[model samples]
Target: MADKEIAQDDQRVAVVTGGSSGIGEATARALAGDGWYVIVAARRVDRLEKIAAEIGGGAVRLDVTDDDSVAEFAARIDRVDLLVNNAGGAKGLDPVKEADLEDWQWMYETNVLGTLRVTLALRDKLVASEGLIVNMASVAALNPYAGGAGYNAAKFGLRAMTRVQRIEEATEGTNIRVTEIDPGRVKTDFSLVRFKGDRDKADAVYEGHLNLGPEDIAEAVRWVASLPAHVNIDRIHIMPRDQV
Candidate 1:
């Protein structure tokens, strides 16, 4: 909502997709800590419920790839001051020469299409509330990876999607603004997921230096949302101190 219209509990009623773990979990907790009533959604209902309990928010099971599920979840959200379109990942980090088609499809569906699904589902509420969307993009969206062909493609598509959506919002005269948070090398279950739960392999992602913690990003999200309505943070690129 506008700066003058933002109520005390306005930020509380938000939907955080991919809220089961990592950055999503931390963002939910951070918002709850700020006294915003949050709704955590993800495929892992059990985990989502746990996060809700910890943060005193609500929970919903959502597979961003499924339109029906996303629509139902959107319907369940009564008031959304913010939508953290954070459900995404990197899959099949292989060179194009040996890449499997399934990997490309999964990445596109989850990373790119998933963001689109949730955004469309919540578009009305956002326009009504003049809310903002924080998309969890990665530095990968701006950098090409040797073995990250599929992942990069999906992220690049997602980046384009965010830009286009912003333009559409302007043309549609919607008050809603969009921000993309691109973090470089984060330490979370992300690496584990990328490595198919291989602890040793995942551990190597942050072996040399300290990586961005989930809460660090959670705080960044909070700051962006807390800004005055007139000052929209177009995008934020966050990297760990050691990364540079």
Candidate 2:
């Protein structure tokens, strides 16, 4: 169904960033199946529309890295019961000595600043509903390797931000829930983007490895969001059986 044709869902609403593909797309589908009114937001309007239609949800063009775009996207939603901060990715895999400042900047902007913008904009709605916030962090936040300095820094910052949000919400007794999901070695477009479209490089990352799929992470998001209001899941690290 088209966005206009889809009737309002009586259940709670969820806004998913980076919903055009990968973990974000899977989360949108999962949440909608679980009876959420999902608003799939992404920079790719075409992909968003397709996903929204596929799941009977709404689609909105969103560029989280841009403040104005985020503001406009938030303005379109009257209320949000859940916010999935999934609009982030790794850029290049060059070591620090050979790293490009541009790549690091892009990662920080999308992963760190983008989360901040959307969180601030939709905070009131989340507070109103005593809703949940899920941050799509990564194992990089916990362990840093060579050629992953920039991605590590960005995810580490996100972890810190998530912790602060949890503390603030608790101290204020808002009853809102905050969760940080650190996924390890999930096979998606993540490696593709990180390798700057090098198919071989991307494929090599998952070759002979038992990696988690996008659906796996989506399941985690759905479960966390489905918990009772009194329950709060502070953080969870999801790793494939063979990831360690």
Candidate 3:
């Protein structure tokens, strides 16, 4: 019996979730330029298809919060050298006392659980490639602010999860490298989403502040993934020079 042939066009493959826009889309393009056979996945198929076409990568419609959708997406890929778990967002900005429990649940489901689901599904393929996992966290993971309870909790959980995953993989003698990228503030749809599509509210967050761009974060991702196998960057915190 012959082994099944995997149709691989590049030596390394990277799966970027939430690749329809912002950092995810930028990362997909950057990685593709760096010679990775990139696969972009997200719930927005139309946008994903456009990005995929532009980058010469494949697109898979994926809702990271859905176990069945994630499973199907994983099955379609036979190789994974890098998995960028970037499919996450913030919900509302109400203080804890006035917070919506449903909003918190949504944040947890998308940020933490969604990352876990996709990583677990691709664990084997990553192991096979001695690959790297980049979990896109945020400064909110480290700092708690008024009206940011839900996002803070979710990202903090992700930070803990990424650290534990690093330790466990090391203990198990797997060469998989885990990195948590905590960006201070990026000019993206993050605020828009958190404000429930209120562009005025969203625009105000970065109005007077110099914030990092999606391309800046994407550059960090590319550099980390391009490093030699022996050098594992445990975590990276990026901020615009004026952020501090």
- Model 2, span 108-209: residue lDDT tens: 999999999999999998999888999999999999999999999999999999999899999999888999999999999999999889999999999998
TM-score of each: 0.93, 0.96, 0.96
Task: Give the lowest summed-lDDT range of ten residues in model 3.
Answer: 1-10
- For each predicted model, how many residue pairs clash, with residues at least 3 apart or on different chains? 2, 0, 0
Clashing residue pairs in candidate 2 (N, C-alpha, C atoms within 3 angstroms): none
Q: Which ten residues in a row have the lowest lDDT in candidate 1?
A: 1-10
lDDT per model vs. reference: 0.84, 0.92, 0.92
Q: Write candidate 3's Cα lDDT for 29-84 as tens digits.
A: 99999988788999899998899888777888889999999888988888988999
Candidate 2 lDDT at 15 equals 95
Model 2 lDDT, full chain set:
0.92
